[model samples]
Target: MSEPFSLLMAVYRGDHPVHFQKAFTSSVAGQTRRPDQVVLVQDGPVSPGLEGAIEHALADSPAPVLHHRIERNVGLADALAQGLRLSDHDIVARMDADDISLPERFAAQLPAIEGGLDLVGTGMLEFLDDDGSIVGRRVPRTGQAEIERYARFHDPFSHPTVVYRRSAVEHAGGYRPLGLMEDYWLFARMIHAGARVGNLAEPLVMYRVGDGAYARRGGRAQWRSELALQRAFRRIGFTTRGQYLRNVAVRGGYRFVPEPVRKAAYRRFIARGERARRSTRIAR
Candidate 1:
């Protein structure tokens, strides 16, 4: 673990040129404990504008850059699996094109990669929009017991904020295509394989939820969620209580709630997260 580790960042052309560049520069170079090497796995052929952002970000990056561009648009699962195959470190951290990392993300996480844990992820501050403005945080439970309990319900940690041991991923059979919820799919498999998982009680990355694919909610999106839940249930040999509860809420409470009321509830969830982080510093 002491030799050095690589950070694998995946960039789909879905991001705007300015925001993508800002995230790459701020998250990679701006880390307090910088990665020894950084890999930018582009999901498809880049646009002229995105190409420029990639160029500038790499040129200015403090870590060595490894750029992999695919001819076609491979989905998230394949892209991340390819990045993991290309990584040469014991630890491989995940990042997204549209999100920013806090300075102490890895510095705070690397030490926790001790003993038997296969992966370590963090709680995250989620941005309400693409402007890096904070909306609220998702505070994940850390430690083997709590995370294991959480996994029985859903994904144990935030997908983009994890630093995982490569060996553990290989054992879990790597990331697979699961339409919209590849990260959750992988997490379920890892837990079933008896890999030790933990979440750091820190907001290492800013997750942009409503700005992208998650912004649209319709039949297709709902179907994808249903499929993801089914996959999770199959993996664990039982239906998830959390998924059932969500369905009940959406079908029952959400049906009666006004659109404004639903939006207000979500905003309050995020704001409350921000308030929680204000009292606890995950850094030592």
Candidate 2:
């Protein structure tokens, strides 16, 4: 028998209703292997349109939907922590409010989860917000060895594409208020605690990259947050001092570069990675 699981997500005022509707439609109504339960956390007061969208999506959902509302904005990390606590299933899948999970996302992830892996995530295709054109793809390192090695320098899994064992996450102390790098932080802790992590090479989610997404990642405040996260990882023995310094030099350099240069560099890197992934598939 297959292991039953719950889907966890958080929404807030800033999320676009249309995008949220698409996200919900894809995650719930569109999944080939449906979740046993769905837990949606309203991080703060949402617009009436968003409320209607949530209502409309749940009106026909096959799984039982549990909607938890927070009186005010508490950010994604805190909201997700609350949702994780509220979720009743041992296997919980994470989804973002504005991204579309492919129809086979849950189906593809279940094997890894049931095969004793503590955490599993898949690659994602990124699309632009304006015309929804394919912008790039993120194919993170897969398998226990590759994932553990990658985790030393970067996030080895896509946050929204991940389906993790609830007990493992809780054992790692669950989610914390770790600024923009909360997911990274949790994964680091999980790895440090010897959690078995894996990644599906196939892209299973359509991630929306807004116009300001790259810019948002390049600011001084975000740079500081990234540096702090790296330092914390080093202190916790998740990453070595040399690795932390290398990460700081590379990641920090991008934050100070011109926005256009940074954007171009990111695009180039994604294009190369996507090409390599496609070539490997063809070779196989």
Candidate 3:
């Protein structure tokens, strides 16, 4: 028999009606090798209609769904931690309720895990509409050393697009609440601990960006959060310039540049930066 891969999903009231169910269903239905078990932690009581949505979605799934319902909301990191604790497979992966996974996502990641990478993340496409339509692609550069180097400056791996070895996450003490920077905190710990991380450089998920409970906060609040992340990055050794670039990427880059050029430019700049790092490494 083949080994089982555990997919841990954290769902909450933040998920819009039917959004999480669609994501969950898509994950299972689209996978090349179905996960051994899917552990979903419902962060809190969602809308009354949500249960029906989940039930209808899971009824037809190929994999078994293990649902954990929490009475109160404890934020994202805590919810993820609880879900991770419930995962009992060699491999672990994350999925957001509002996102859609490509069929080959797990297939692409399994090789990375088997290749000895502690965490394997893939590129993502963003959807502006509620349905599974791609608006823009978030392409991440591949390779372990390059991923680490880029992570020092910015979050090279999108959170929802990652599949990780369970051991590495345990080594990092699981996820922690850091407001808007929780994923950043965990990823940094994984990198600093010498965990072998890599990116697939392919869009394996459709992430629904700038929506849900957090969407109403407007640009100024987001700017403040970015500033907070910049401050947090300082504590972790990211240069002031890197922090500034991240700010620009989130605040200015997305808003100003047209979709056609922005992502292409982002890819080019990231590739250029990685090459520059390689040069520095050889020089040293």
Candidate 4:
């Protein structure tokens, strides 16, 4: 039998009640293999409607829910680190506040962990609206070597689709406050620390793409974060000076480009193996 796992998620006042409810239901109540427990961290204050939504969704959860509240917003990395500690199970699965995890999301991931992988993640489809039609697909390299190679350039795993061992993650120093690149930074450290990792080729999460998503990928703040990431990667010898310079030109340069150009580059390279845009309507 697969080991028990905790489903971890975080929510702030910015999260919409309706979207949170959907995310909660699909990732927990609607899953074929339900989690052993739910660890929810409220990053900050939430509205009454959102509180109501959380209460209703907890009612539908298959497993008991463990809750945490941060008096102030501490960002995703810090909030998630707290939830990770609160999780009783060694195996932990991550879910975004607005993404829809397919029913079989953990069905494959958990067993792969049992099979010895320290971390495993799956591909995801991006949706623009709540209508369920997929706008794009992001599939990372599936093989072990492919993942190791890809990590040098981009994030090798889809964050929301990740299921990982707590010990492996903690050994890598857990999540740090790394601006928007927290997930990327953590995965890089895990790889460098010799943690076994892999990816599922099949898409298991419907990631909600919000407005200004491309623009958000650029701007001064993003550039700063990208610089910090490249520096950190180089300092740890995870990346060579040559690789670091190249990333600054390619990935770092991605931060200041115009939104239209950034969007083009993202779909062309970052999306990886995307067959154009898949408009297939995903069903529950």
Q: Model 1 misses residue 103 by how many Å?
A: 0.8
Best by TM-score: 2
Cα lDDT of model 2 by residue, 44-103, tens digit: 999999999889878978889999999999998999999999898999999999999999
lDDT over C-alpha atoms for residue 109 of model 3: 84
- Show how many residue pairs clash in every candidate, following the order shown: 0, 0, 0, 0
The C-alpha TM-scores of every prediction are 0.83, 0.96, 0.79, 0.94
Q: How much lDDT does each candidate structure score?
A: 0.74, 0.90, 0.75, 0.89
Model 3 steric clash pairs: none
Of 2 and 4, the candidate ranking higher by TM-score = 2
Candidate 4 per-residue lDDT over residues 116-226, each given as its tens digit: 999999988899864667788887677688789879988899899999999999999999998799999999999999999998878999999888888889988999999
Best-to-worst order by TM-score is 2, 4, 1, 3
Residues 197-235, candidate 1: write the lDDT tens digits. 888776778877663232243345555665565655555
Cα RMSD (angstroms) for every candidate in the order listed: 3.8, 1.4, 5.4, 4.0
A best-first ranking of the candidates according to their lDDT comes to: 2, 4, 3, 1
Candidate 3 matches the true fold with a TM-score of: 0.79
Tens digits of per-residue lDDT for model 3 on 93-156? 8888888888888887887788788888887777776455655666675677777776765787
Worst 10 residues of 2 by lDDT: 269-278
